[model samples]
Target: MSQNVKVVQRASSSVRDKLYLPAIYDGMKITFKHFFKNLSDINAVDVLRYPEEQPQDITDRYRGLHRLTHRPDDSIACVACFMCATACPSNCMFIEAQEREDGHDEKMPKSFSIDTLECIFCGYCVEACPCDAIRMDTGIFSLTGNKREDFVLDKEQLLANKGAFGEVCSCARD
Candidate 1:
């Protein structure tokens, strides 16, 4: 059996294309055109004054800050499963588990903290949780802090955070 081999010819770059000056000039021309146009009509450019002007288009699907969900009894939903920490690519999650003091065999987190500075906001922790105990639906994209410790959210802070709809509990489970 004989196979036919085809050789494709590559296109050679012209002198102007090699220099790239023309392409650079064209890019600058477009940039300046938009700059001047926006300068003339400020309203043409959509600029949000941030902090004061919150974005109106934050959909339900938007992945923002992480929040720990609560059970119907107002207790934390997390059973100290360690699934979220294992699934975290950034290893920002830190959890300490302990046996529940109540007459239940289920374990609970003694301490659960997430270093927001180190977190990549990948939503893996939320997905890995079997109990739907964790979620990134707080709609708090603008994370700010003076010290690094401020960004590290503990169980209390995480539990305080409400969902995008301003609910403390996961609506899925509720």
Candidate 2:
């Protein structure tokens, strides 16, 4: 079998193109245009003085931070199935299961923690949970901590977090 090989000629660059002055000027022109426009109308630019001005356009679908939901009796909805941890692509979630002592005969997480530093905030854990135990609807995107351990939220911390409406549990079942 014979294969036909096609050769293409390369385009030659002119002296102006080689100098790159035109490209630089075009870039500068666009930069100056935007700069002056923003200077003339500050509102036209989407610059927010953060801390003082929080984002107001966060939609309902926006996944910000993780939170644990609760049942009608205010018990954690997590059944310690490890579904959230398994679905987490970043391997940031950790859980320890224990038998429920409330005569329920079901298993529950004795300890559940998430390393925010390692978390990618992909919302996979929230989606993988079968009991709707976890959710990212807290709208608390400003995650900051001085120490590494502070970033790791425990079961109590996760349960304490509230949604935008100050509701501790956003469980749909409740």
Error of 2 at 127 (Å): 2.7
TM-score of each: 0.77, 0.77
**Candidate 2 lDDT by residue in tens digits, 94-137:** 99999987644378899999999999999999889987888888
* Candidate that scores best on lDDT: 1
Question: Looking at candidate 2, what is the lDDT of residue 143?
Answer: 83
The collision pairs in model 1 are none
> How many pairs of residues collide in each model?
0, 0
Cα error, candidate 2, residue 79 (Å): 1.8
- Models, CA RMSD each: 3.9, 3.4
Task: Give candidate 1's TM-score.
Answer: 0.77
Per-residue alpha-carbon lDDT of candidate 1 for residues 1-174, written as tens digits (9 for 90 to 100): 999999998776888878998989999999999999999999878889898999998777889989998777777788898999999999999999999865433788999999999999999998899888999988888888899999999999999889877665553333
